[model samples]
Target chain A: MSAPLFNLRGVAAIFSAEMARTRRTLLQSVVTPVLTTALYFVVFGSAIGSHMREVGGVAYGAFIVPGLIMLSLLTQSIANASIGIYFPKFTGTVYEILTAPLSAIEIVVGYVGAAAAKSIAIGLIILATAAFFTPLQIDYPAMMALFLVLTAVAFSLFGFIIGIWAKTFEQLNFVPALVITPLTFLGGAFYSIDMLPPFWRTVSLFNPVVYLVSGFRWSFHGAGDVSLTASLGFMTLVIALCLGLLVWIFRTGYRLKP
Target chain B: MPIISIAGVAKSYGSFTALHDIDLDIERGEIFALLGPNGAGKTTLISIVCGAVSMTRGAVRVDGADILRDYRATRRKIGLVPQEIALDIFSTVWNTVSFSRSLFGKPKDNAHIERLLRDLALWEKRDNKIIELSGGMKRRVMIAKALAHEPDILFLDEPTAGVDVELRRDMWGLVRRLRENGVTIILTTHYIEEAEEMADRVGFMKGGRLVLVEEKTALMRKLGKRRLVLTLAEPLAALPAELDGWHVELESGGSQISYAMSDGAEKGAAQIIQRLGEAGVHIKDMAMTESSLEQIFVDLVGAAAGSQP
Candidate 1:
């Protein structure tokens, strides 16, 4: 008999498969982020915060906390999603997903959703750890959560794009390391964009990660060097752009066909 | 109605064409085998029909629904068992199959899931992680996953390539059961024996073009070559002048005569037997060896390649 139509059930299948794999290596997806966040708090929060004054009416430790959380969100989301997809490509298992009845949208939502969930989880862990170092008050918990999830989803989609583009394992890791890592660091993860001169501030504004970090930081401390509305607008556009690109790639079956 | 209609399908990677203009009509509830060598565009053809690959020029309809224009509807009508073994190693066999069913938007049906697992001889391994299974068992799990969705058409791409004999038998048996249940099964394989044993219709592909598509038995009878061997009661000293016109060879100390036939139109076999009788060589016994599906494939494909520009 012919199979039935597609719907949320497809998303669940894709998402469950993805989540099962990420859970397979809890040490990497979960423990590594926690440990790295702790290290950041120690080195950047205490060491750097000890000497440097606060930029936005918050302690250096608390100020860097938002950036650190955003960094974790962006990196983990991309890494988990990219590696999750890359393994299938290498093992030739991606054909299973591609040939299934599920639409390209379902595949993206499943993988990107799982990646966002992991990143959000790790981001929360970092946020909790930051609390141990410095007490911070949230201005809007709802907006923070929304921005956090959105950032994860957006970056995870971008990571999925990179995963699809990468033909080898080395290429998979290269983009996240060389491109994503450096961009996050320079996006004011450890500092504020206001400290830079006008020319550099304008340049920082161009970095998508800057808007993501700035918007997330604004949600947390109710203040940021860049305009919060502008950051939100940029993040929304980035999310749409990445989503559109992913859908197009999936529709075209680029690098996915036999 | 035909379950899948591939009309003038072609695929290309930049300037290189992977699949050329091709047309195929796969009826519902039959096992159709696509046979070809490596890079013969078997996978590309299946991919296009399943909507996994974009076609450069052509359209495919699954149960009358266009693959590209009405993808969701067409996709829901088929189940694909890809060549690659791509199960999440950490997931249990049961979970993987069940998840695959849900992917088709089917409601959770534990009984259906259990039945598919049982049919594939994977029920006992349901709780085991995919990584823990052997290669053959993993292949069975792939079959189970494909059947989970209960689609009208099931596409198996090299289902038994690395599987063991027993598993292959079990898989074939399962495919037969699926066909009996009215599932249109389209399978691709380099294993000629698989097509010979399981296919109702055979389609031979060469260099992206479908060279021939016919009933398995008809193709064999029409194009299948045969060798005739006759054993004489006494050894012959030399070749007879009357039998010189035949493509005959003497074997076993000149006691047997062998002749090859390209098709049924050749009456040379009867002539050979008549010549032996007329030559005062009493034939003790004789046997005919028919060409295997592999032989027919090689001959047809080899000829196609030789004729290529």
Candidate 2:
């Protein structure tokens, strides 16, 4: 007799299943986000673009584009990943995943990777939609892509953590809708911190999403309220923190083991 | 070789203990049944052995690899059918079972998958979503998933619970075949009858402790008993002095008399009939009742529970 072996085959298997599951509910996974992004552009971009002048050396329409993309990235990533993890617990499918020969890391990669990929796709769709509202430019196209992926990965991992921590369906929606969504709005998704008073501006800097949005904006416009170096450093720090938290949760089997 | 060896394994959730000071060694090619009532920690013990749940104290070795230190190795040798039927409803059974196999790092073996599906009578359902299958079919899928990795030792925690009788019988037969092929199976079930039917050895657990573990037949012979039930033609006012040596219960408005006898080399039903006739109870109808596995289980747990403070 030999001890079991683990390979990416298991990860791929689980990943394939998750992707299939997400794809099956194409309305929620695909159409809903597309419609939401359209609404965001129509309501926030077109309606608010005319009154506000260029705040970050970019037009109001263009300035909000990156924020809009990040908004979709964060919400979609979190929603997809959270629902992905939470549904299994709800339907009892999680037991199959947990009892499988796959390691926890493999489970994380399969689930969070699928979630991040989904978020990136939805964010890209929203970004594409932004093209109709205002002409967008990409100063650092490669960097922009990299930041988008990192942001999706980070937020998806965060959502994965939230999914595990949440016990019920309401608890699942509570944090993302109430906590993360509010933070994104206040993080200057549709506006810049420069317009805020000094105290509020200082306070806004504490929001991690601000750095993500600012970093993403800098990638597109080469202009942001925060320094590029600081934003990149801050995003890097956030990624590390998210990864560390996930690894610790996996190691501890937090809310995973019965 | 023993497929699994559990030493001093214990699991606790905060202040509440789930399993206490448990030790189990399961040999290859045998079905070991863990019989316990609900909340007796049967699932906890199996989960610990299968690497699904962590033990607070002690260790488990699967095929000589420590579960905690060498999880991949240990897990590869084991398959777990949890008490819950957890399946991705949207995914086809083929993908689900194949994924479970690959999760153990086994290469793509399509033939093996087909054989398993066919054996479990799931080949047609392989292309169907798990949610579409009946409860019995889904249970078979759970078994297929556990067998996907071809583990040396499989842990089935209440596998037949709540399942239809046909499916339960099918699962028992499948387990028997697996045993024939040299897979050591550890099963937890509330169905003592299932244990009696399928187990080569049985371990009874009560209050988080294994009360007894022995060969099935040896346990039955040592603890099994027979009760002589006598229906009298006339009501007996009292037992005669000749029957004083035996423990007898008067029932059915004193028209029936029962004598419980511990099984031994010399004791037989003939002796009870002779004793009753000699006592002049004027028996009209007589029958013997043999203790079932449940009776043995009840007796064991009842005695264990009574000894507690």
Candidate 3:
């Protein structure tokens, strides 16, 4: 008999299941983040806005909007994907999928694709919520959307790697809590790298999140801490790295086959 | 051609071996049972064939396709009901089963899924999430999902472990029905009776090796050992000199004497009784029991344990 064909039905099955799960956890997925972003707007907008008035040539509230949205987007994308794959590993349901006729890339597309879709939806929703608090402008709407999508898919892919690498629930939380969150905060999310001391500006270069923020903020204010080309190059590099690592995972059967 | 063939297949975890140079061939449309105790590598062997566990060395082919090179082909031919309760606990039964079918590239067919649910007696509970169902119900869902793709070969890994009698029988009936449709079935179970009743051929694995594979009836006939028990009319304190010459032991307050009768020991019982009568021992009753697969399984496992360590 011929090998089973690869079809959209397979991806559709997985994607639909994951989307339904999102709907089921609507409160946790949408409401919690929106509420948290609103709180960030209130506290940071009022407390710091009165003194500085503006940062990065934009209102304090608007400057932080992209930062907070990016923050939630990254975390949510990771959480949605890592938990998505990890729970199956925990429950052992993944064997069914692994033993199926679908290729490794197909499975990745199904999972990472679903995660990216959710993160993008939430990203857009957060953008809508931010409109109420501060005036917004988009110098490059297409580039902004591109960055949002690329970031979501890249981070979701990163999350997929973490899911396969994590042996326990504690390992799942380690990178997100101790690594991603801290990096997002320090990578010029609240303040432009130019505003920092010369020494601090050099240190921020080492943080990859700075590149993402710089490109994304440039889409809004027409300029950022770094050139748009460098930001795009960095994003492309990360996406390639994530895909390369995932392929290695499938080839080695690391933490998957036992 | 054999549906599944394994030659010199071996698996090792670091230094500890899970399967050791195992070789076997399973013909199409046969219910082949791999019987072994826990840690005997029954699950490991099946996992290797299904491509869930990579082999350290050797090759496995399903339907004439190499498992590693043409993985999708082999995997598409096989349906595995893994030992774990591997289901999304919050997904409804219909969605889980249908999703499983699509994963294997099978088209959606509500009528087929409906029949499957009806066969498993899960049609009424189709809307219930997996977590809300009982353990046995969840097991049925696992079976449903495996058959959803309608593969030519099915591997049931410990299908009835910890299951109630009703569900066990229900599952066996389903297996028989599946086989009737020309689907080859390979099942691994520690429950010897399950193998005895269901398998056309039985393989005994121990210490990561395939120790024995034989037709069920032939194995029963060749290795069958029976026991004969004689109830004494009166309790005896000790055996007489004539009885001492025979391989018999007294039990049940010395009122019963038992003897292990190997294959072809046709006249052993009669001769022993004749000698007992000559010794003035009155016979009250006699009972005999043919050895079952359960007894043979214990002996085989015990022998393997003894030989290895």
lDDT against true structure, model 2: 0.84
Candidate 3: segments with Cα more than 4 A from true spot: A4-7, B227-287
- Could you give the interface RMSD of each candidate, to one decimal? 2.8, 2.4, 1.5
Tens digits of per-residue lDDT for model 1 on B30-148?
A: 89999999999998899888767778998898888888767777777788888888777878999888887887788899999988888777889889988899988888888887788
User: Candidate 2 chain B — worst ten consecutive residues by lDDT sum?
Assistant: B263-272
lDDT per residue for candidate 1 within A91-180, as digits (tens), equals 766766776666777788888888888889888888888788898878989989989988888889888888888899899889889988
Task: List pairs with backbone clashes in candidate 2.
Answer: A3-B73, A4-B73, A4-B76
TM, every model: 0.90, 0.91, 0.92
* Candidate with the greatest lDDT versus the true structure: 3
C-alpha RMSD between model 1 and the true structure: 3.0
Best by DockQ: 3
Q: Which candidate number has the best TM-score? A: 3
DockQ, in order, for the candidates? 0.53, 0.53, 0.65
lDDT of each: 0.85, 0.84, 0.90
| Runs off by more than 4 Å, candidate 2 | A1-6, A52-57, B227-264, B267-288
Each candidate structure's count of clashing pairs: 0, 3, 0
